[model samples]
Target: MSQPNTSPSGRPATLAPLFKASAGDPLLAMMLASGGDERIAAGPDGRNRYGASARPEAGEIWFSSSTASGVSRRGWQAASAALPFAFSAGESEDWFSDLRRRLLNLLAPPGAQAVFCASGTQAEYAALALAGARARPGQKIVNILVGPEETGRGAPLAASGRHFLNSAPFGSGRAGFALDGWEGAAALAALPLRNGAGAPLPADEIDARVCALVRVARARGAHALVHLLDSSKTGLSAISRDCATKLLRDNPDDVTVVVDACQLRCAPAQVRADLDAGFLVMVSGSKFLGGPAFSGALLVPGGFAESLAARDQDIPWPEGLADHFAYFDWPPLLRDRIAGPFGARCNSGLGLRWTAALAELEAYCALDPALIEMAKACFQGEARRQILMTPGLEMDESGGEPTLIPIMMRGAEKGAADAALRKLRRRGLHLGQTVPIGGREALRLCLSAPQIVDFAWRYREIGDQNFAFGPLRADLEKLFTAWGALLG
Candidate 1:
């Protein structure tokens, strides 16, 4: 492999490796190849199948982390740094194990474990498998997904123990078949977070519905895998943490609560709290963390694996799972619990992607907590203000953090919103994809951790008084200006 040219600061002189890692060993090829199916495939136009390129583009404003983002400079550097080592340790467990350890240290509480997957949807599939393994012999697995419309398109299929995609990340293609040993093992129940009017339902109403479903599942000898959505696509959470806790306490044996924190927009403390409460948490590096797409992990609370171990029930590993996950994906404690001749290999791309994401996360976490909150507040307030002030655009007022702002075009025809999105992208302003809210389709303006950290640094350098007049507001100004032109 050719060596990267370095400058006096010891950084690569160019981002060549960031876009395409230098070829040395065959393992580097595997790392680049593992971005998964159509989700990350680049098209003939040099863009990924998602219409975004793998490499970061200059002057392209990215407000799309609520869906996906190209690899940020920080993430790219981290991935580049890992390349040499990843090549050296081809298929070895050391690199993957260390990646898992780093993830747990950064996001999990003590004794917590993590199962890495190729994407958030894949993590959902892993969660279902774990829930299915824990079900009693006579009990059926009933998956209760919150905010199904706002979550991944493939989530329902994954929750039902079927292949959500035509091809798995690891190069296995089996579109709609039930996973091996999983046929007739699980059923899906969806609880919409919003009512028919596109209005968010009351928390109490959502809680009541969840309780009713859990009770029904329990009465029917079913294990209820209820999801607590921390943040959906447009940043709306369905069930409150307190409600999830109560349901778990009321039906500990029959209830399995998984927090769909795939957006990863909540605080680390919130995730630790979920783990402390014995709930499985799913997080994505590709979302708010601003990593390259297709990086996700399922966080297992401490002692949860031991509990599964104690069950000693012979849980047959679904043969289809071998296509999506490798042996190293699970922590040591879980490897032996599910019996199967699974792949004893490692996914180098998964490792590299996590490495990149952890870089962004660590940098963001290194900033002052107060500063982080302040930056988010300023950005959200300004972005919301601009969106409201813009003509022909209305904000979707579902209760969520300001990180993701969903706005709809007034009187837009069917599919016009999507065309407008393409127009905005062509004009060099990138926002989130269109999401359906009630009868209207809305586009999102999202804020990522890297964006916050960037603003925070500028804020610190320029002092608090000049902060408001700085780049943060300037970015919002640029966004609203482009939006207004599109409306015109």
Candidate 2:
């Protein structure tokens, strides 16, 4: 059969033939069936009713971080300069590395090594591969701990034969583990960090359990990769401090820990402290920074860099995935044996995405701490009050001061939650995906800097609940009005 014709811009003439041709590819088939195209319904303003719109919507209220982000005016301005370059550049010109440096300087400490990936999942796969490589040569198993929740859409796709330890409440604890078919790994173990109600386990008990797990894995000669949850869909600061300390402080040999900060919501001080304590941290530009979707970077500190660099072989990434990464962007030491098919330049939109992220970072850095605190208080208070009055929504109070609110939709079936989302979108308000929590359908409304700052600009006259000179009351009223009507 003749291949599909190409458009002038080089895209397939039609997606239908491509979908049919993709019958042998599981991932492609899933994409065609996932309704992703319909899910991002565009509004009259040219933005997805969800965020991630290329253009601005004057009054759109976005509470969706599980999905992509909306472009801010400043972000758009920053990204615009790169469009010509992205569309016309013939060869890669260290654009990704430059972006990596800017992000590291803003988010991490000096001397921290960086690697840019297509998405959080790509960075995570590299981390996992490095973790397995750090194991002793004769060891055939590299067991890992995944906590709070796995929100990176590409994570499972990257795990080939590794064992995962579930640290989320009521999580399966073991994914990708098969005794008979085990190839890249040996065994898996899972421990609940929180109970079914979202309350964490006792600190001492958690510490003891983790220590025991590590010791047992050591005894069995398995390499342990401990994942510390910095923030994910469940909420920020989801890990138990005591448990993380025990795992990081006095751990067994052949163990490595990575702080999953992919949500990009963690503070600079938090990241510094974690890196100072010798843990690998992964962060993304797409989440809190409001950049375009699928941009990620890994901050490799001294010890982890040394370990990963010492390995002479490349991490056995999935077949055909090397093309998606900018291996040259990795720290020079760690780039030792990573072979190519590597791009000559940044991925299609990465340069523009990073530019947008850097623009947001600049604004965020210049904000007064007092203003930030005031905005946080205002949004949290309003969100909590709104949740109480909304009929179908209930808050998941398993974590901190409601940075990312997880809610279960009452009377909504497995996929009925999407209908509620659609209704909200039609009203020009966008919430995140309806995720699965404990066999029930759930959704998240994440607080973002752009949202808060925009509100501050639009409602500059209105005072907050504390009678402070911040947080426009009108914005909250608009959001709550839309929310109540949609869910009520």
Candidate 3:
């Protein structure tokens, strides 16, 4: 055996070491061999697979909002700074308390209370549970799907043990049914949740349908608890604010509204309006905020705590679910009773991840609105121009604006879009992943703060140039050119 190598800085060398050992030590030898391979490939491209290269993979654009994101340099810096606090003395004090309050001030409606959770899925579950607890004796949960594409899986869990319509089949894939059953608190889907187009439904129709549903629930000895999706996979503003407001006003007792702002793409005015009207808005930092994946929170309106306290002792909160919400610094009433178990056991990594997200959100908020709009226009104009010009590509213009652009590929092959995407990824370019659109595979070009700042795709190349807001003609052209060549 031999000692490990060291760099001039006294840190371990970048490469691994191997040495001869006894024949009886086969396991140790194998471990040494694996370590050596890891060291050599540490800086190489595609070493860990997924096509990343040593010299920095080119055109590593990220448009997938759900799974992952390209964290900005500032975000990484904030994480590095906040990590020690999270690991050490951060637990005793509410380290993220100030951060959460600031975020609520910036992103949520005035006077809204926030509850931090691990991911959008978890937050949605918590929101559903909270709403279900408020359900009246004859009321049932009604989820109206704007499209057949289901974005949040935990949604149907609110309807667990109750029959729900228009939701994805129960127990599809890895997800199972919710365990705790609330008496009249179970969710009931407003069935046939199928809308192919991404355009907004008519306001009158929206109001009428929601009100009618509430009436039906009332007649059945139940209130209609609606989880209206403001934006899901399809894009922002999926449900009309006018409808949400009208429903709330018309059926104050019969209807409870939860605005699914999971994408975090809702405009400031829109979010404030919803919150002001007393709607619960759920948002994730991982999406439009461009933080790491899975960080999310649920914003509760003022007086919500009082309303929850007014309810009887039974809220049907599933056992063990309280642990995920342990990060929230609850108000006195909730602190003592409702969510006492929460914050009792917290995850340091989640707290650190949110701190990083807060950093990203801060940077985004700091930029001038005019500059962001201008850059958005520039990027969208160029992208649309090239997409139309490209023979194999077509733009899905039903929903458009600041970010999350969807484009359809012209071809008959089942996996044509994904196949071309793989080719580009192999060439060091990663456009967003493939998603089902209109019964076919399509691609999304989601823009984040890093992309808006015109940072190069290579992680190391960011911050090498001054931040700029200008035409993205070159970048769009490059992406389409590569895609065209691959199609050819």
Candidate 4:
């Protein structure tokens, strides 16, 4: 019955009614109208994320954490200035060397046992390259993932499990898979060592556990290379942890383990432990740390790294590059020429350095001590309101990453959801539309917004109503007071 209105600063006054709303995304409308047609207009109006594209008009922009965090302008400026420096991989001899030695520089460690890669794809490629060089003919290699049947996190298929499939001899013409649960426990107590559908070996009985892989690799002989992508947001994959505990207990010396830490770089202690356990680890600079995009690193055991020197140069190794998992490839060298200090398996051409992001993360790595406390305090008041305001949105009260929030509308179907998004977009609110996820269309809001605009104060006064940023409450009410109107 009452109308909602905004004060000069875009704050809501009270339980306001809807404002006049349009059906298309506000920015898209601006861009399209600039052309006056459904097809996008061209010329010097605006530039899109893809670069020089007329799709994104001059004033209108697609929100992406990719180019910059929509958090604060200053934060974005700082990030860009740091890019060139960040693109250079840190080495003891480089400008970033000192920074890498610190805890904040997890993506690129000082005194790197190996250069992980400038990108995750490259890091994975590096790992595969190592595998090709090391695996005995007929030995199988495996790639791993986390998440359940449909909801599990999948690294691009181009990147994750394809390595072994490409390395034929050990595969018995068959590929290997290493899967784990969200909690670092095995999926049905299965190990990566086992081939598909092979009966899992018993954990308590070491011999039985050994049999799983023994049987799978039998046709290819007893050799196999295995990779574990720490798709687990926390640290260890459920299956990997369970298997690791048993594997180390029974026969640690027999298995070669490599971990994809590309997503788990923030969890340093866990990564260090994985390295100590003789697993090679890959990590990226972006994701959690919000660093430069094309930067990441890998950690290899001192012994495993040395093993590279033993390879015969006469043999040409397969290229191990991927779209996401790994990077870099070393050129073949004469056996006698290989007698000195080595750099890294891969090098970032733009140099895959995220110097600035790592510098920024120095404080976050110390998060248990300082910044996290401030963040908690900042969110304390808003947390209650958010928990209450979200009528049918999905948020895990139990446990999940605090940075990105993935949500969905309770009753809205795909088309309905899309239409509503278009309506919201016409206003200035600028939230993301639903994308296909886990086989269903869902919406995601990825942010840990740095304070810029006063959001909490506005919500207390108005619910889901955009200020000047959105259509007024009275107008929205006229548009959708009934279910039939929305249906049409």
Candidate 5:
């Protein structure tokens, strides 16, 4: 097969194949088919409406991982390599099992298991299914969602056990309908991380709100699923890990805490710690991991799945989930326990996405810890400084990790910020979508694993002095210059 045509500068043309295939491979086609409604539609130019293409477009500047990112070259190669194993007859099951194991080995502790989902929102639904399955007869699952405003738009609906979007990622269901067997099985209690003024609530106050919600659930003999936000869109953590640990300890039978680390800005150590504390962790490879968009997983702590399997009571599989999850999505121990008619199938696109993500993650994990920190610090510090110095922009001071910087547009009208974003796009620069902060909307400048890795390689080549005056600073200067022109 001939390689897809490229421009003189080696950038892929608008209608280039998603991969380097001369002819369309059915397995490769599944990569684009694995996501939700949003992933399926593309404009005439062969890019999504968001102006992102499945293949890497070297000409575009991407700082939009907080929203979505085009696949990195490294990730694309990894996915391409896995095509044979994924397509091999009878090997698909083992392929998926291997993927689940690889992910756990890299991101979780011993005995941990994972179930793949197409997106973070679907992972929320998977968590809900698990919580619901464990609930005693007549017990309501009280879903305590932290910082819903700062998370995915569909997250609250997923927490309530309904389809977050109009179309399911895999299965068939109308939006707003309860998952099969989940009708009236759950209730939602939202705890906004920020106050009315858009300032993040104090950790103590946030902790109190979580505890109060759990108390109310307990009073009603409900099962409490506390959705803790490790990092939000603007880099805010709503509840402290200490609070989550105490809640689980105080009510071991009734409370289940799940960490929403979807942004994946924190260290791997943090994820392990959450699993160690007996909390479920949800992460997205598409975010800070810098994989192609729509890869997600629900990390199950050691002994959790085993315990669920050991229960003598009948654990009825939620029929509604059949549309969203496959039989092999769960670990072997629980697969048979889930009495569903769904066959042993999996999402090929999801497997490919994770393959790409693991490639990026392994490369990232191989770097010296100090070097990674240095790159992150330098990038964050430089970005913050530039945002402060730029006219018509102000930074969000609610601090978490420095990986994502959200900046507000000063004195801009309702549509002006969006217009600036489009202008930036035309200039070959992309940023995170605007997020509503208190009364204002802010655009996020995000860092990804590939970006850091690129810096690491350059830093090694040029040494300290030249590295300081090199591409990292130059890129930021260019970004801010384009940004400033739009504001003017």
Candidate 6:
């Protein structure tokens, strides 16, 4: 491995043998294979950065701490340095302008306040609160929630939440929703769950029912629950256009759309189409936005945010603040909607890191596109091909439309998956493994960050007996490639 040539930070360029060397070839295996790497020493880029972690092959690993550490350091500095506009953002309009302009171009929406929050969950809560701000206290606020019905989804419903219209069928009564297959979307819409409940319908046939959900809302004399739909997970692109057509009609004014773009930075362009159709865009920097887990943002559409802002004339909440939404907690910023229009941010170390990471990413993405494609074609693409080995390793559909490409070994014997995992660990390779969709054991090979610049060389280093890379290489090839060798 080469040391950083002219790096003032004294950081080594390649993976260090003692700290990074695996049983395989490369001596300097990065921590978060692609997206994040924590450098023991500094580099020319900065003392903290380790350059986008998470790139790996079938037999390598990616670490998180590396890039996370970098993002944290830089973001903290930038955010802390920000003029702490607790009340007024009279001067920082330019900075916010770049942010706002980019958002408009991507979301393709007109009139939006690109505001930052602490995290995605907070963004969701804030979006809901903003929506619920319209509630006339007993004015039926039907908060429609669609997701796996886990992890803070219930927060909004509890607040002015009268009808939790599950866009899909759910098992657990705790706002249970079972919206997975196309059929499920239809079934839930068929019976409409009767606002409260009645005869539960199955989604087996009426798979396209999700489209008619608006009709259900109208019938129940309720408004759209602002659809807490996170498109990052659900591939809204795959949904039949026939179903979403009416919803997609350009009516940014009539309906209230609050999108949880938790996986924003990594998301493709079409995602903006969804945001453009909404009254609010909730972006979280943690997931794919390349920031700490804490910092998130709420990009509110146009003048609506000011309407929801806490003002002198507006009565304080709990004077109508629902208990369910009491879970939406943030150090309140007393911004008068009328006094000044601006982005009110929380004092968070992670928040600082998020801003810096964004700046870095924005810069990197502004390079030569053809060169970028050529580089990807030569590097990561090849690595991906190599990792999808072994016929039985089935890739599961990631909900968040994950930047991490995940593969699950389906129907493998109880010890089979674990045995494979152990073998990889011995070889100094790690994987993202978990209990798969149907109680199945799975392993995911993600190509997201600190990458091996010389991956091809590492691939060739296998089985050089003088080093450990050789034996481990044989072991892995035997596990999967042995069959290929036999056939060959």
lDDT of 1 by residue, 1-488 (tens): 11223222222335335435444323433464365666776667656655566666777778888888777877877886777554444435667778888888888889888999889998887888788777777578999998889999989888888887787765566666787767888899998988898888888899889889998998888999999999988887878889899988988788889999988999888898899999999999988999888788999988777788667685546777787887678776777676754553567688888898998888887888988788777877787789778999988767567788898999998898899888878766778888998898998888998888787777777577356337657777887898898789
- The runs of at least 3 residues in candidate 2 whose Cα sits more than 4 Å from the true structure, single-residue gaps closed, are 1-51, 87-92, 148-150, 153-200, 203-205, 236-242, 245-253, 310-320, 341-345, 409-414, 436-440, 455-472
lDDT of each: 0.80, 0.59, 0.56, 0.37, 0.79, 0.37
**Could you give the C-alpha RMSD of every candidate to the true structure, in order shown?**
5.5, 9.0, 10.2, 15.7, 6.6, 13.7
Q: Give TM-scores for every candidate, taking all chains together and pairing residue i with residue i.
A: 0.91, 0.76, 0.76, 0.54, 0.92, 0.52
Instruction: Summarize candidate 6's per-residue lDDT along 92-155 as a digit string, tens digits.
Output: 2334434445544444455555544434544543554455454433333344444332223333
Candidates 2 and 4 compared by TM-score, better number = 2
TM-score of 4: 0.54
lDDT of 2: 0.59
Give model 2 RMSD, 1 decimal: 9.0
Model 6: residue 380 alpha-carbon error in angstroms: 6.5
Q: Model 2: how far is 407 from its true place, Å?
A: 3.2
Error of 2 at 312 (Å): 5.4
Ranking by TM-score: 5, 1, 2, 3, 4, 6
Write candidate 3's Cα lDDT for 53-95 as tens digits.
Answer: 2222234555555434644455655655554444342234446
lDDT of 3 at 446: 70
Provide the clashing-pair count of each candidate structure.
Answer: 1, 4, 11, 50, 1, 56
Ranking of predictions according to lDDT: 1, 5, 2, 3, 4, 6
Question: Per-residue lDDT for 1-488 in model 2, tens only?
Answer: 11223223322334334334234233221221111122233445544434346544567766776566666677766665444444432344445556767787777777788776656665665676566667766575444545434455435434334323221111122344421223555344445555665565665675566667778877877777666767756663434555666676666356777788888676777888778777778887767777655467777787667755666665444433343454344655666545433433335355566677788876776666666776777777777877787777787776563557777867767777787777777776767777666667677777776765665544444644344423444555666677667665
